[model samples]
Target: MTKIGKKATLLAASALCLTGTNAVAEDAQTQAELDALRARVEALETNRAGPANGDFRIGNTTLDVYGYVKADFFYDFEFDQGDTAFVNVIGEPSAATDGTFGATIRQSRIGLRTSTPSGIGEIGGQLELDLFASNGTAELRLRHANITIGDRWLIGQYWTNFQPLDTYPTSVEFNGPVGIAFARVPQVRYTANLGSNTVFSTSIEENVSGSNSDDPVLTAAAEYNNGTYIARASALYGNAQTIDGATEVDQWGVTLSGSIRPWAGGLFQVNYIHGQALGPYLIGLGDAIVGGEANDVDGYTVEFRQDLSDKWNVGIAYGREDYDLATSTGTLAFTELETIHVNAFYKATDNLTLSAEYIYGERNDVNSGQDFDGNRIQVAAQLNF
Candidate 1:
């Protein structure tokens, strides 16, 4: 056997008996032996678990494979909202139903991560994909592909810097709430960590909104996290063009978000956003630009979570977005959208989970002078690897 292997075997044999008559010496020796045994067990798990536990090494680099296969079954009680509880569809009249049942595995995703030592620092990258393509087909969609230089620089496609990912609410649904800002874009980002509690990041990202924008968007954010508490602020600015490419408009946005854990197993999170011509970044809530001008919009999300037991946790989240659009004599558009989600997650096994959620969504049509709402019940089963 290899020298290291023999040493491990010998250590295991010597530490098999951890008790002795002498109190102090026995305590010290037993503690040392336990530490050695723990390290050996960790090494064994790292090597034996392979990709299952996302630990392994190849050559000079470490590679981790992680993701889960999630299948969701949902029943919509007012409108057929399909896989996602799209609140925008709630106010629409067509396809209205008393009940509609659907099942989808499109939320399932897989990722490969690599880290290696370099001259400057540790270089790492991630390539992740999911089966939730916009076309409704179960095609592979790129989630993130990024490379990190040291700890401060990131280059590639990833979450936009304007997104306060640290304080974002969690839900069983893919896109949790309506008022939250959500988008992934290609960008080059620079991050600065001040002391140990504060961080700042800035990026220039591609515009992927419905309103075409040839110019890149500039985004910046700052955050402070101290164990159980977090606070963040983010902003973005850019220029957009009409679909016909005839009109040009200015785009800008800002968001403030934070989270706090008061009790041992309880957490509260909230965020507020106000912006113009930023519908694309706000979960397609309202028009980014209309008639040569950017529409004004604001949104907020409030959430609370508590762990009931070691294997179960529950949460409730509420989100709402409002739009300020020109009210014409006969024009029609959405003025407000809101959603509420209450969910419970149960850990069935080390690698398996079960979850259920109830969602209520509402849409207010200003010009049409109508209000519509819908309810959804969803249950999901996920297997992690």
Candidate 2:
């Protein structure tokens, strides 16, 4: 062979070898990528079977569990009811007997919450239950079952929009005060933030006490908060029908509530509600609309709390509800309800608290010139989880 031919042949062989080596390396890289993908698929399948962390998950949804365990021990000096005082009943002659001692865990509760991502917003739901049930038995009862679509809307059972939650006073009793507006009902609510400090909310809630009228109760509220202070005004309107279906009464109420921090570790809260037929919303103290005529009612509550130290606090609260009866007979049936609470709380740990409270309640029947009074002392231990 000529010298030029020999050199060309040698270069051609080197090129072929290089091309073969490149092909082998490419094949090995492809196999490594396939192995990585397969391992990732297996890991995801394992995770789908159960949650690796504390929270449960399914697809894009995440579920969390939470609640508290509480035990309350109480002694009644002027009433016999073993549970929290129902002022309306405790004021009756039948309940005037004294010397009752009781203990219960009925307030302990468990709840489940879930959040899932969606196209419009995050969908969230909660299911909560406690041991308060029918016939004074220790059975699970639903407290809240509701769903929220982002921050704007909510559906199902939740705290009524007509009340200000921030103004609620701390107390050992399950039913804190007589004059506080409290109710949880099935409803559809819309909430909007007007600015950094103002919020407006409205809802249409199911009226369990409305007689013949099928229309739901309407509620609206506006709240303003500026670091140390919060103020709110809420209103409700509904129709109540008599059981006979012969009479329909107009029911409505307006509530103004606020909380202010006067100094470091000191706070004050006040609330006032006045309207016609506010029985169901005002701790069931009286009939909203009694007889054929609607009852006009007024309620007021005031509370002050002072933090003594990082682990100790003291509070005092007073509440009253008064009703106006058009007929003399109605006056005898329902008249006035009032309550006072003084409490001290100690934080045993970050998740544990111990508290003691003295509660005094009174009721009066104006027509009969009869007054019933009750007093109770309660101690409670609560552990949060």
Candidate 3:
């Protein structure tokens, strides 16, 4: 056997020997043997678990790793940046059937979760990572790590209370709706069960903006479920922003979301969020458009979903985001950017799923910020194990 393999076998034999002698060995021998056996077991466990690869059980918490893979096709229409509203545009554009297609890994993340023993309070947590093409590289899209204490207290990074669970739709592209919480920063939270399918949660977390400041974020939410329907409302406040010469003002937002299962296999979902800026950079500017004033930014989104059958589903999503530019050279706030996405999915079997989607987006300030309109049609198959 290899050297490492032989060592492992020897350690296992020693552990067996010590355990076997404990029944008749003296007290000193028993204690010494037990210590050696525990040390050997721990060493082996560490080697087996490896780094970043974990399947560990500590106390009542168990941990595992999991993730998903995805690919897509994309295209762009009205892909121009210069003046185009009055006559012939300054740039050439292409449509969906013009052979514009590409693939993306999107996100392939791994995470862990654990549950409390039966009849006791429960706790769990997870983390995910993804690849972003905009910066020509992979990035840490979802860095979440959290823990629960006695079902009432939680500490870690998770989804903000302001975002609802139903906001995440099943899509092939891996992109989510705007004005939604894809993930949250580290936080301390409290949860109370109000009985009969009702839960109330409040949290204090660092602002998601990776900036250098003392401002913190606060969130509070309540959720209710009554057989066929689930509804949630939440509020958030924070003074966080960009660090590279960009000053974001204090901000507050509100979200309301709900889901309903009207029939045996049909589902309905709705979500809304509104935010206001609270600093000099955000004063006097329209909330839906940019360049009107300082710190002016606001956005909203809506989505509808239908499950036609066990293997097919369709959805439409729309979102609008407006920002106030720091200078007049920047594009108009309202016409800065807008996006719409439509998608569908079909499951071929228990393990294979196929999806197709179309994405349309427009940017008002193409010269200053590379704003343009584009379209994408994507189809991919995924296997689950």
Stretch of 10 with least lDDT, candidate 2: 45-54
- Tens digit of lDDT per residue, candidate 3, span 1-385? 4333345567777766756766665777767877777686666564543233334446555555455555554443444211111101212332213343355555454455655455546555655555543454555565567777777888887766666765555555554434444445688999899999999999997764433346777899998988689888888887644444356555677777788887776666676655654221111222321233224445556667787888998888765555544322232322244556688888888867788776666545434555545555557776652
Candidate 2: stretches off by over 4 Å: 1-54, 210-213, 326-332
The residue-by-residue lDDT of candidate 1 on 1-385, one tens digit each, is 4333444566676666534445466778777767779798557444542343335566678777789999999999998877888777775667489789999999999999988889988899999999999868888999999999899999999998988888788788888988878988999999999778999999999987675988999999999999799999999999778888888888898999989999999999999999888787886457777777788898999999999999999999999988787322223367788899999999999889999999999877676688888999999999997
- Point out the worst 10-residue segment of candidate 3 by lDDT: 81-90
What CA RMSD would candidate 2 show?
16.8
lDDT of 2 by residue, 137-247 (tens): 889999999999999999999999997898887788898888878888899999999998999999999875433457899999999999789999999998877677677
Winner of 1 and 3 under lDDT: 1
lDDT of 2: 0.80
Q: Each candidate: how many clashes? A: 0, 2, 15
Cα deviation at 112, candidate 1, in Å, is 0.3
Give all TM-scores, in the order shown: 0.85, 0.83, 0.67
Question: What's the residue-level lDDT of 250 in candidate 1?
Answer: 88
TM for candidate 2 is: 0.83
Using TM-score as the measure, name the better of candidate 2 and candidate 3.
2
The weakest ten consecutive residues by lDDT in model 1 span 45-54
Model 3, CA-based lDDT: 0.57
